[model samples]
Target chain A: MAADETAPAPRGKVTITEIARRAGVSVPTVSRVVNGRSDVSPATRARVEDLLRLHGYRKRSAALPSRAALLDLVFNDLDSPWAVEIIRGVEEAAHAAGAGTVVSAIHGRSGDAGEWMRNLRARASDGVILVTSALEPPLHEQLRILGVPLVVVDPMGSPAFDTPTIGAANWSGGLAATEHLLSLGHRRIGLIAGPPRLLCSRARFDGYRAALEAAGVAIDASLVVPGDFHPESGFTGCNTLLDLPEPPTALFAASDQMALGAIEALRRRGLRVPEDMSVVGFDDLPEVRWSAPPLTTIRQPLADMGQLAVRTVLRLARGERPDSPRVELGTELVVRASTAPPAPVL
Target chain B: MAADETAPAPRGKVTITEIARRAGVSVPTVSRVVNGRSDVSPATRARVEDLLRLHGYRKRSAALPSRAALLDLVFNDLDSPWAVEIIRGVEEAAHAAGAGTVVSAIHGRSGDAGEWMRNLRARASDGVILVTSALEPPLHEQLRILGVPLVVVDPMGSPAFDTPTIGAANWSGGLAATEHLLSLGHRRIGLIAGPPRLLCSRARFDGYRAALEAAGVAIDASLVVPGDFHPESGFTGCNTLLDLPEPPTALFAASDQMALGAIEALRRRGLRVPEDMSVVGFDDLPEVRWSAPPLTTIRQPLADMGQLAVRTVLRLARGERPDSPRVELGTELVVRASTAPPAPVL
Candidate 1:
């Protein structure tokens, strides 16, 4: 729906009355949508939401009573240890702030949005921290109407300019990992890349390319295989790269799980890590150090990111602007037994 | 405080008036404590709680409004991947039941009880599922006063008789793991035991002894090592075993993490798994299957136990008695590349 009236207030300062007038809805109807009441019809709710977004209306700070004493942490899925690390950080921070933390998983399925929204309303959570989940406009609009502060951790795509986001320096991490392998006299390096849809994944891949260019090594497109940041994909991707006419002497995986999976694949082929093929991985998860060949990977501060997200969202809930909208923590290279000079050619 | 009257109604059927009179507090004061209000003095709160427990007070079925749409999941600490597996199950089950899950970590500190109780009251959660956290009497009394349903998962010790609990057949799992080693012709086996405080740990240790007794083999105290169910202990324990004049041919660790640590220690000693010394672990965690030697472990249905705990607590929240107050799921032995017949004497 388009605005009915001429330009009124500046973006993010429009009044609720103007929004309702533009949407052709009664003030109470707009109020019902804001309160997450079920009495409003879907069509009117959608139209009102559109007007709210179109006008960039912002709820006045301190408009409502003190927010609920609970914070919500949303995820696409809760199957990985990576998530657990984040949860630990969020839980600790929230507890320290005297707020309970409600965790919800949307399962990345089509119908999960409605269920998730309902749960959000039911809990009346004060703030939200979404980890690597999409931020569709409709969902954003609903959250805005409820005046719930939100922060994104490792956002799936580029987050809204105004939304606070916390992420690791994936590009620099990828570059450092690839450079480490190159410094060890490895010219032919295969890459197991994460899904291209994620901005972080893209950055990592670009960093890999940039590192290769800096080293004067020709980029072999066939050596780079696609992965979903999961072990299974890593396994298959490694196998695919291994079958090439001339395989890479070393490998870099975008994630530690993928690196482990690649190692497994090499083992099946009767090859050993570092001795037969060197490997580097990102996200130095806790258990990687204990892996047969201690993993040499990038150390992404996952728990710290989670903790920062909670603190940022809580600050926003208190009507305070964060120092910055986006924060990228540094990643470090941890040298372990996984990387070594390529074995002498027979 | 003991009940004042000689005999009132049967246990769990006492009236609020009686409890107030017994505790020498006003009716509204008792109500405040019951509803988790902060107005009641700490001394009064404790007194009222004792009386409530003494009379075995039970809130009538359907007395409260349809309970809050949130369930609390508390853990002593959320450090291990094992906790993540349980969390996944609880989150899934709670979501399916249209309830949000609030996760809290008490960190197993001395003063965490008050903080945890405050968080629980703030959320007004409908039920609680405590995972491997001590259920001290004072904390139990507070929960009882609030009338919140509770289910214990992997209780640290034997759970209170009336409290519903979900656990695996630890003793049987331990027995089966030991027997597997024996059947593989490993006459001399070492044991890496978990903490002595937990009932599950004690049972596993007992099972190991039972297996050896059944096989007509004498227990060797020197072959047993104590571990806190962590990798560090396992590493040190393995080193201790290797220092023995005659180290056992096979080893069984009480937990998967401990088993992985033992493997690392053996690796440092230039010993190969199964070929040099066979190893078996408990809790077939997901990552174990991808470990260097693909660990042979006892599968302890951790996720299933978590799911069952949520279901049981929800049932109790609805004022329905569960099928049983305690449930122990079965465990199975998973043979991977980590175990084999003991190597013949050189």
Candidate 2:
């Protein structure tokens, strides 16, 4: 370390000019690296990156390059309507911010991250809003080195401590859904839990357990079944609970898709929703309201979370600290026709 | 017009240098006008635009401006699952081609077009795919002047004949749906038509009439009702049909959302689908498969259309003529549980 140079350096927020001065390069060279151009040498790129990290340099909101402002939104897959809701939210908010939204689905968790990264580097995106957890650690570091602002929506696990994240109140949503069922006088409530790997899913499961314990109802290990948050898993989970020696009268699915699946499963067994069995779902997606027996659900503000992600990322891009780095939007329980009092015990 | 300069102009695509020479301006000035940069004087912009339009200047597939390749997808509104399906398709195809997709909803037909246009001008988008007919002729002309490639998906009314468009076989879908009901021994089939303003909707309605004619079933005008292709309209249309002195045995809704609405209306009236009144829908959106008595409907190749739009726009951007200026993909009838032989006349 150059002690004299370090002593003269500002305490925080170094500019490209200062970085270039320290790296013995021109201002344009620093600009090229900052803009993610391919012309920089590997050694120089490394040195600049080290200094950038050391100084925590954040590019101030200078006049953007001649190109349009773009916000990249990445997802693991775009197959579900859930993804659509988030896209709508992000698109709306990004548009409001005078930024175009670039949407990408990386197929699976991590397989296409490299391709996406290459594309990201190729484009001068203003910021990145990650709606999926597929990107690995090195990519995150690369983004940081590039000085790109990032906001994660519904982060799967413990993201970097400083990474700003937006998510629904999964735990509270789960608890409220279960509590709604309990209030309807159902003691034996089947729990269709989302994938255990996801933090949101785990939080929801914890909420379900908390609700059950709060009501002084014994947790029946046999009644809880795991799901991957798809309708197929929900169907399978519902059947698993139904085949048990003692079946719960009402069931709560961690996702609307799963709830729809569970309802279909019950239908196949010649049972009626709310009559033969009561069902509750999470993520009150639009179509669920028109669902047969109209689903009772926990409404995750998916679009709001998406909108907030864009706002937070833009704030970071402007070199402003957000009031909260991690925000969990409140979730609410919506009672429709799906849940009802348990049928008179035989 | 500069006659002496015009004499030597190329007969086909003009280069930016040639345009600059003809316009008596710097190459960068003409380039700015082409790139939608607002810095150029209005008078200079008009002169450059006229020369470019006269010469049919197309930005050749040279190295793009060092920004990410982006294909803009615009819709009147992003409220429907139909939009989501299309978005998924476009996003997938754009990803495959190493291009990013920028999605925007103009809100209504034309309310937000100016804002979108401003954003579009501020960005270096490679191509545009219009999913709505909202953008007016002036905007279209502006996009043309900017040399941005354009494609239309499910265009409403008659778009400019030169504009390449992608759509589903709406007439065939409608014909097939109505014929299926006729084959199911139901002579009285209600038709829930989409807004007549859209050409696709008109085509579907025409096919419905043609099917009835082919079956020698006099089309009862009273049985057909107009809808805005929403669930609420479908519900209202279904109720209207049911109140007739002689109600139809089955109904075909123009879109899946309307079909869901119709089903909900029936549920409210305590009428079971298929057993009481058979129902069919258009646009077999993904979630409809999980709908109660899973909707039997015509499946519009929405995603396929979206994918084709991306390919077509990219091709136009490359200055290649597509095989067809207007292409309609086939729509197939998916026979699920919603349609069955109408219950024996009581």
Candidate 3:
């Protein structure tokens, strides 16, 4: 041991041998007490524990108990507002369930699958709730091997694992959004689709096509544009669509944040929402309601989804198989001041 | 074991005895390999490690590794924009340091001190960079008991412990904000303060008082309103001040979020910012820059604070006592379009 406390030491890892020496006990006895070995007598156990505390000797890593008491609340990205709301919901339920959450960021799009997998393997959480669907194949496979009770939220594609999943009826919500514009007598409707890789985007696109077909309006591929489900992407996508020779009379964005951006783009070009271009959005977050014109959007049961995810994971961790392996929660369309009948073509 | 696997069947936890029996070794030999005790052969060590993985026999409650290969970036509130930016900064630094983060939120102001204590006692983190003031007595005492290498950010009132801390130059920031208002020729300026228990708030308030005294302006006790560092509190506090018979011509909020809320409250009463009353805020968060009229704010070195906090905690965890127990960083005043000369008295 060095006398210079402030000196840059190579490393200061305290070992069990040091604790045993300080406690005046055999290494085996110290191990027994640390591991709570039933064979150790009560008197010796107390003495060893006291000594361990005095020397700041923590429990050895190898003696970890088999049962997990903490829960892992996995989010696809830490920066997204949608994830924030869902996390708050999950946190509330987890608190009520007497479980602590270990938050891990799983970057879905950056191709950083190895980093996320390594984290999942290194951190020992009791159970896991996957809150995003954009996880790459390798990371998803790694999670499967993890063998913990798992729950998936808003899963993008088909059910890949035996674990339970909870998600909103995204397709129905898309239909409602498109139908609202159609009911407003807007025959030429354009859609801002989410990333092509995401299942939610595919479903929403399907619903959009279905709505147009049902209304006897020709489905124009040119009216659909791809977006990355971000505000900036929405703004860019809206600008591209609006640049067409005969642009859509109405626009439907898959997310509210994107819709807000679309409004900004429209305003920048001196166009008013609904008056010049009608817009409808999905996921009516609080900020959407506060937007200038108050966005017309679809509302998902985010809080309920969070509660369901936690409950499902807890049930699986407790060795109880839930009745439903896949849950599709409902969504509702909220009409506000953001949408109106398409302006008469001049 | 029971045959029924689906109905909450108890799979008795695998113990060291079972591992020894399966490996065909004595209990002491099994213990030696599991604990990485000296004198264990390589083959025996590998066999024990393989079995441990196969059985998923993790310790129920084990302290984090003494020499952590990763960092734990802890924050009191996860939803705040300021905290999020700081976390992003920590994430970038930790990535550069070849370390990972385990983000855990300690719900402050919700009055859940017991939960905070439990998480601290669990010792799930290697090193803690507390992005909050440990002014609460119970939490302060618990920090002493846990004794993990720690760093406090923006610690208020008194030093919670001898651990290193890093925070913005709150006193200077406060003075800058106040001086900006004074330069705008606003003599009747109101202050929206953070919690009194927090040292940052006290320093900012001291700066506010000093600026007024230095300018030969009399301090009006009635104009000073205290609030929790929350937007809602700011809204309420602003309403109270605005309702006073002799209202101030300007407002200086201690936080940007608070300043935004104050602006909203002022708008509700048909008062325009800078035109009717000037407003100055602290912390130039992204939202502040985009806010209507753009905010004139004091910018704290958020990213720097986060990086320093992580580095200091890691050093302390490695048994190096830092020379300075507290480190005060600096802040800059950013003059945007929010402040202007006050309107003449009605």
Candidate 4:
């Protein structure tokens, strides 16, 4: 059963069962010997060992038992300061763990996925953190078989399959945002909704509806304008709501970028914030603090989500399973100058 | 004198002349054979060929003659939207070229240089685009010797070595920014500068001073508060200027970020932009267009700089020298709502 030095054998093609069949031994015996478990008899161990070496079969742990040197970070786009904040958190975590990071923008796979995947494998990245879980299943399987760890942040569409994820309590964030406006005596509140396809978007939207339902306020379709969580979308959404016969007295944008856009739209129409309309935004990005009138926002721990993703993926890379499949961090309400009580009735 | 397979033969270490000596041929004969240049006798060619193969000596073209698949982008830091604009431009250009990009932030080295350099080598990046030219000489030589192409954007200190570089007309940008503020009929103008070590900062500062001198206004050191090109710095600079016994009626910030900071500082102190004081900024970042009152600033064509850097580095990777060692694109002043004639004296 001695193996030839140059047998031209390759791994990843043959499974443990196949090896067991070839060796005329049980699958457990083959596995035991391959893992150096030592429970197998000497004769069987030698036979299985020779077969394993000849076939170039190596367990996932055997290929890279040590920690990986670099982490792969994939994003839907790199256009927003939101991405920068996430990058900052991930970089900080990666730095602390003594690992380097590589960032890729897939943009819904516009054929960039093939190139990015090739580079990831070539780089032998220790793990991967995908900011948006808008990926095809086949690609997920491909990465799984290659033994590269993966973690998702703010999954889009539906929940990903068995992939650990880290995200903010977006529903709670939405609820708290609406409640803040309600406490300030805002009954006629308008909402700029995020993308409908994303689960986080739906959760936040649902939470907003729940708050209104609890307040005994009737749902007004005209007050809810759809947006893509961008400035232009927010601007358009706000303008649409403002054009209504009886416009909302207070507006809640799903994102800070969108809120800023809404503010711009309001100003262009010769309206003032708080005095004319109160606005509250989500994701309390740093730039929002410098926005005119400042910004009252729901603070989603975007950086924490990034840091948590790194930690989760690193754990997976170390061959350890995460404690939970999904981890939701808390959100906070930051009241600044953008929000105020509705103007006194004329 | 033929090399043995296990002779510890370093591929890049041995010289062609050494191969010639071993092959019993003239230096010219060896050179011609290695370069695949004809006109060498078959007998000599056969001898030199055998020696070349034995020693593992191959031309540079023999290795990765194809264009690289990944481009490395290094930044001093990635905290600014300015970086995002540049990234957008480079990513677009790189996508067009079917090349992938990897971004890194050095934070003034922080000992991350070794990790970054190692990653670059392992990935065999086709080229490198450095946002700042503050790299150490040894690291520069290492990249050059490894045949990795390099380009610099907005060189921080000065023009780098033979490496091709892309930069903005920073002096013109500065002059234009200050000139806009001066045109508003303001004699005492505050200046918030960027990092002093960067060449771009020095140029802009010089331009601001020149604009004042040209207007026959004496410079006031107290009115010129130094800043590090961030929002907080701008806020502090504006506050410091506001505290001066003789305050300026207008301000010119070195970057859009600083301008935003100045606006925030003004708003926090119960002041209004343009109505209270005119303001001008350099680097018309995308966010600046959405800033309240928009912004009147110099447009640096940051995205174009990114695109040009990729084209330049790709050319270098193709073994072609650029038309010039340094290329400075133009900067234009964009008149937005932020600048207005100073309020009539009380």
DockQ (Cα-based) for each candidate = 0.38, 0.52, 0.11, 0.25
Question: How well is each residue in A1-346 modelled by candidate 4, as lDDT tens digits?
Answer: 7986444344434567778988898887886775457578998877776676556453433212332267878888878778877887887788667666667678876477767776565455668999874767777865665557788998875554789888889999999999989999999999999999888888888888999999999889889999998899889999999999999999999999899899989988989887899999999888888888888999999888988999998887665679898899999999999999999999
Ranking by DockQ: 2, 1, 4, 3
Which parts of model 1 have CA positions greater than 4 angstroms off? A1-33, A36-68, B1-31, B35-68
Stretches of candidate 2 off by over 4 Å are: A1-18, A27-47, A50-66, A109-111, B1-18, B22-24, B28-32, B35-47, B50-66, B109-111
Of candidate 1 chain B, the 10-residue stretch with the lowest lDDT total is B59-68
When sorted by TM-score, best at the front, the candidate numbers are 2, 1, 4, 3
> Which model, 3 or 4, shows the larger TM-score?
4
What TM-score would you report for chain A in candidate 1?
A: 0.84
What docking grade applies to model 4?
A: acceptable
**Residue B21 Cα positional deviation in candidate 1, in Å, after optimal superposition:** 15
Candidate 4 chain B weakest lDDT stretch, 10 residues: B59-68
Q: State TM-scores per candidate.
A: 0.86, 0.91, 0.68, 0.79
lDDT by residue for model 3 (B1-346), tens: 7564323111113456766777778878876765447788888766765665445332232343222234555556556667656765666566555455555565664456566555534434546677774436555554443334667877755564566778888999999899989988999999999998888999999999999999999999999999887777778889989999999999999998788778768866878777887888898875455455568999998878887877777676555667678788889999986799989767
Off by over 4 Å in 4: A1-70, A118-126, B1-68, B122-126, B145-147, B215-218
lDDT of 2 at A258: 97
Best by TM-score: 2
**B-chain TM-score, every candidate?**
0.84, 0.89, 0.75, 0.81
Judging by lDDT, tell me the better candidate of 1 and 4: 1
